[model samples]
Target chain A: MKQLVIHPERCTGCMQCELACSFVQTGTFQPSVSVIKVHVFDEQASMAPYTCFQCEEAWCMTACPVNAITIDNVIGAKVVLSEVCVGCKLCTIACPFGTIFYNPESNKAFKCNLCGGDPACAHACPTAAIEYEDSETKDWVGPWAERLNESFLTALAGEPS
Target chain B: MIAGWVGKVLKVDLSARTHEVQELNLRWARDFIGGRGLGARYLYELLQDPTIDPLSPDNVLIFATGPLTGTNASCGARYMVVTKGALTNCITTSNSGGHFGPELKFAGYDLLIVAGRAASPVYLWLCDGEVELRDASGVWGKGVWDTDDMLREEVGVPDARIASIGQAGENLVRFAAVMNDKHRAAGRSGVGAVMGSKNLKAVVVKGSGSIPVADQASFLRSQWKKKASLRDSKGRQNFTQLGTSSTLMPINAIGALPTHNFLQTVFDGAEKISGERINDDYVVAHKACFACTIACGRVSKISDEAGGRFLLHTSPRNWKMAGEGPEYESMFGFGPEVGVDDPEAIIAAHWLCNDYGMDPISAGATIGAAFELSQEGVLNGTEGVLEWGDAGKMLQLLEDTAFRRGLGDEIAEGSKRMGEKFGRPGVAMVSKGQEFAAYDGRAMQGRGLSYATSNRGACHLKAEVLRADYKDPGHEGKAGQVARTENQISALDSSGLCLFLNSGATYDDYIAEFNSATGMDLSMDDFVTAGERIWNLERLFNLRAGITPADDTLPKRMLEDPIPTGPRKGMVSKLGEMLPEYYDLRGWPEGIPSQEKLAELGLEAIA
Candidate 1:
C-alpha cells in the first residue's frame, strides 16, 4: 500500500505543505487548521512536517464511540465522516501520534486522509520532504525520534553526540 | 469583506493606553495596494507636519502587510515598516520577509499603527485579534535572540512570531533595525530607533485566522507556476546552494566592492570571504522564509578553533552550533568594506548585528569611516585604536556601538555625523546622512544615480539598474531607466512579495497573482502606474520634510573623486550629467514634482 513518508532532514520549514493541506481541508489559506504540521527547532536549525502514519492498528477508528470513522476499501485509508461526528474529541486523545486535530469552528475531527490517494502535502512540498510512495506500513518517526533523544542526552551530559 | 485584505486596521495609542480597530480604507487599499505604499499613505495622513522629529512621539510607526501576505502564494511573506527615519530624517519604508507579516494578517489586522510614546518600556501582545500592552522590563535590555526566546516562552504561545529591537535600538543607534524570526531583519533607515524612542520593545503575534482568496483556482495555478519557474531557474539554484554571498566574488570582480571606505573600488581579500568559501567551510544547513521556494538563507557554524573568538557577554544560544547568514550585503559590509578578510570574523560580526538589532551596512560603514579618519590623522588621539582589516577591533566596535560605549557613541551617530565631528566630512561615503551599500558608484554609474535619488537615502533595493549598469558603465540613458525601475519596485514592495523572485519571475507574474488573489483586473501598465503614484507620494513627503533638490545628490567622493585603481580607474559618478534628465523623466522640475504630475497620479487632493 502507498504510504506518506516524511524526510525531516529535507524540510526547510517554509510551511508550504501546511498551506496546501489547510486549503484542501478548510477551503482557505489557514495553517492553524492544517492536519499536517511543520515543527521548527530554531536553536538546532531543523524542521519536520509530520502527519498521521496510517498505522494498521487504526487506534482513532477503534476509539471512536460512534461509527463516524470508517475505512475506505479503495484506498485502505481511514476517513472521517463529519456528518455523523458528534464533536467529541475522543479520537484526538486516543491517537498516539497526535496527528488528528479537533477543529473548533467545524467541531469535527480532521486528519490526513492522504487526499484519498494523492496527498496534497506530498505534492505541494517544494523540497520533497513529504512523499507518497508504495511501501509496507512502517514507523517513519522512529529514527528521527531516536536522533532527537540522542541530542537531548548529549546536551545533558555536556558532550557532543 | 475584501477577498485578499483582512479589512481591519488596529490603531494603538501607547501613551493613552487605548486601542481601537478601524476599518481599512478600501479606497486607499485600491490605490496604494498595501505594505510600503499603504504604510506611506497612512504616515502622510497622520504626520501632517512633515518637519516633526522622527524620534519624537508625534512620528507614528506603522507595520503593514499587503493583500497577498499570509497567502499560499510563493514567497508571500513580506511586511513593511514605514516611518520618518531617525538616520536620514526622510520618510523611510523598511521591508522584511518572515512569518511575522503573515502572522499579523492571520491575526486579522492589515495594518498596526503605533502612535504616541509609552509611559514606560512595554511590549504589544496580539493573540488572535486581542491586544495587550505588557511590561517589557523582563526583556528590555536583552539581545534579539534572547528576547525572542523569552517572549515566546512568556506569551506561552509555541508558534508566536515576534518582531523586536535590541540594545542598539534601546541606545537609539541611528541605524538600529527591527529583527524578526530571530534572524530576519526589517533592516535599514533606523526604524528600530523610532520603535525604541516610542519605548516599545517588541510586538508578539499569534494568529489562528484564515485568508480568503478571491479566485482560489486561478491564484493556485499562478502561484504554482511561479514556484515551478523558481525551481527551474539557475538563480534560485545558486541562491539555495550558496545563498546570497554568491554575489560577493562577482561584485568584487566588477570593481564595486568599495573597500577601505571607498578609497579603493576593489578588495584583494574578496576570495577568502566569497560565498564558495562559506559554503565549503562553514554552512551547516540551508533555510527559507515563510512560503519561500528559494531557500537562500544560510545556517552556518563557527569553526571549533575560532569559536572562542569574538566572545560576547550574552547567554549561550545558536551561535555555539548554527546561526543564519553573512548574506551578500552583510559580507560586503563586514568584510571588504571594512577591509576584513576572515570569513569567520565576518560571520561573527554578522551574527552580532542580528543579535544586537543593528544595520550592518551603516555600522560597518561608520567603522570604515572612522578607520579612514584615523588613517588620515583627522580623528584626534587615535593611534592604534582603529585600522583596516582589524577583525578583533571590528567585533569590539560592533558590541560597543550596540551599547553606546566610548568610540561606539560617536559611531552610533552614523558615519555622516561622525565624519563631520572629526572635521573630515568627505571621508563619510554617505548620501542623505545614510551610508552607501556594497556597490561603488564609479564602477556602476546607474547605481550611482539610484543611490543619489533613493527615497530612503542610499539604498539599492528601490531600483533595478544593475544589469544595465554592469553591461555598460556609462552615464547615458540611466535616468529614464532608473525612474521606470523605481516605480516597478515600489509596486513590488507594496505587493507583499519577495524581490528576490525577480531572479526568475517578472512583473506579469506578480500582476497575475495580484489580480487573481484580490480579484482586481489590473493590467501591467495599471500596476506600474500604482507604483509611480507611490513613488511620487514618497517624493512629496521628502520635499515637505526639507530634503531639497540638493539632497538628491551623492557624496563628494562619488561625484568628484575618481576611483584610484581597478578596471574602471579614473571614473566618477556623473550625477551632474544625469540629475536634470532624471528630474525631467520624473516630471519633477528641480526634483520637485509638478502639479500636473501629482494630478495625473490622482494625488492632487493630497498635494
Candidate 2:
C-alpha cells in the first residue's frame, strides 16, 4: 500500500505542502488547517515535516472518547470526521508523535489522512522531501536531495553532526 | 465586489491617536487593481499636499495586499509598502513576501494608511478589524528579530506575523527596510527610514477570518494544475536546488555580475561565492515563505571556525547564530560588489543585515563605493580599513551603518551622497539616489534601461526584463520588451503573486488566478492595460515628485564604461540608443505622460 514518507533533510520548509494540504482539506489556503506541519529548528538549521505516522496501535483512535477518529481501510490513513468530533481534543493529546492538532477555527482535531491516498503535500513538495510510495519503499534519494542532505549534515567547523 | 479584496481601508493618524475606517474607492481599484498598483494610487492621492516632506510626518506610509494575496495561487505571499522614499525622495512602493500580508488581509484590511508622526515610539497592534497604537517603549531599541519575538509575547498572540524595523531604521539608515518574519524585507528605497521618522516600530497582525474565493471549484483546479506545471519546471527546480545565488556564475559568464564597485564586470572569486559553493559549504537547508512551492530561501549558519571573534552583545543568541538568504542581489552586494571573497563573511553579513534590518543591495553597493573612494586616496588613512576584499572591515562598517557610528555615519548616507561628500561622485553607481542591483548595465543592456527608468529607482524586480534582455541584445527590439514586461509586472505585482511565478506561469496564468479569485472576466488585453494604467499613474507621481526626463538616464559609468572582460567585453549599456523610442512608446511626450495618454488609461491627469 502507498504511504506518506518524509525525508526531513531534503525538506526546504517552504510549507507549500502545508498550504496545499490546507487548501485540499479546508477549501481555503490556510496553514493553520494543514495536517502536515513543517517544523523549522533554527539553531540546528533543519526543517522537518511531521504528520500522522499511521501507528500500528492507533493510539489516537483508541484515545478518542467519541470514536470520531477512524482509519480509512482503502488508504490505511486516520481521518477525523468534522461532524462526529466533539472538539474535546483527546486524540490531539493521545498521539505520541504530536501529529494530530487542535484547530481552534474548526474546533476539531485534524491529522493527515493521506488525502484519500493522493497526498497533496507530496505532490506539492518540489524537492520530493515528502513522497507517497509503497510502505516498503526503497530510499531512491535524488542527487539534489543527496546534495541538500550533505549540506545539512555538514557541521559548522569540525564539530561532529 | 471583488471576492479577494476586503474593500475597506484602515486610516490611522498617529499624531492624533485616532483611526477611521474608510471605504476604498472601487473605481480606483478597478483601474489600479491592488497591491503595488492600488497602493500607488493611494500614495499619490495622499501626497496631494506639496508641502509634505518624504521624511516628515505628513508623508504617509501605506501597507496594501493584492487580490491574489493569501490565496493558494502559487507564490501569492506578496504585499507592498507605498511611501515617499527617504533615499530617493521619490514615491517608492517596496514589496515583501512572508506571512504578514495574509495576516493583514485576515485582519479585515485591504490596506492600512498611517499619517502624521506618533508623539513617541509606537507599534500598531491589529487584530480582526480592531486597531490601536500601543506604546513600544520596551521594544523600541531592539532589532527586528527581538522586536518580533517580544511583540508576539506582549500582544499575547504567539502566531501574530510582525513587520518591524531594527536599529538601522531607528537610526534612519537611508536603505533601512521594514522586515517581516525576521529575514524577509521590503528592502528598497528606504521605506524603513520613513517608518523610523514616524516613530513607528512595528505592525503586528493576526486573524482567523477566512478569505472568501469567488469560485472555489475553479480556483482549486487552477491551483492544482499550476502546481503540477511548477513541479515540472526546470527553472523552479534550479531555484529549489541552488537558491538565487545560482545566477552568479552565469551572470558572471555573461559579464553582468557587478563586481568591485563596478570596476570590473567579473570577479576572480566567482566560483568561491557561487550558489554551487554556497550549497556545498554553507547551506543548512533550503527554506520557503508562505505558499511558495519554490523554496529558494536559503537557511544557512555561520561556520564556528570563521574566526568571527567580533560579536554584537546586544543581539540575540541566534543573531549570528542562523539566518536566511544572501540572494544573488545581496550576495552580489556583499560578495563581488564589496570584494568580499569569504563565503562565511557573506553569510555573517547577510545575518547582520537581517538583524540590523538594512537593505543589503544598497548597503553593499554603498560599501563598494567607499572601497572605490578609498582606492582613489580620498579617505587616505581610512582607505586601509575600507580597502576592497576586507570582509572584517565590511562587517564592521555594516554594524556601524546600522547604528550610524563614526565612519558608519558617512556610509549611512548611501553611495551617492557619500561619493558627493568625498569629491568622487562618479564612483557612486546609483540612479535617483538608489544603488544599482547586482547586474552591471554594461552587459545587461535591457537591465540598464530598466534601472534608469525604474519607478522605484534602479530596482531589478520592478521590471525584471532579464530573460528578454539576454535573448535580444544589440539594443534590437529591447524597448518594447521592457515596456510590456514593466506593464505586465506592474499588474502581477498588484495581484500579489511572487514575481518568480513568471518562471513557470505566463500572463495567462496570472489572468486565470486573478479572474478566478475576483469573479472577473478580465481579458489578457484588459490585464495588460491595467498594468499600463498603474505604470502611468506611478510616472505621474514621479513627475510631480520632480523626477524629470533628466532623472531617467543611467549612471555615467553605464553610459561610458565598456566591460573590461568577459563575453560582452566591448559592450556598454546603449541606454541612449533606446530612451527616445522607449519614451515615445510609453506615450510620455518629452518623458512625462501627456494628459491625453492619462485619459486613455482612464486616469485624471495630476494637476
Q: Give one digit per residue, the lDDT tens place, for model 2 in B185-296.
A: 9999899999999999999998756677789888777877787777788888888888778889988877778889998988889898889998887777777777778777
Model 2 pairs whose backbones collide: none
| iRMSD (Å), candidate 1 | 1.0
lDDT of 1 by residue, B106-191 (tens): 99899999999999999999988689999999999999999999999999998999999999999999999999998999899999
Question: What is the lDDT, from 0 to 100, of the residue B420 in candidate 1?
Answer: 88
> What TM-score does model 2 achieve against the real structure?
0.91
- The best candidate by DockQ is 1
TM-score of chain A of each: 0.85, 0.79
Which regions of candidate 2 are displaced past 4 Å? Answer: A54-122, A136-161, B307-316, B380-385, B471-473, B605-607
Score candidate 1 by DockQ. 0.77
lDDT of 1 at B599: 92
lDDT of 1 at B80: 95
Indicate the residue-level lDDT of B323 in model 2: 75
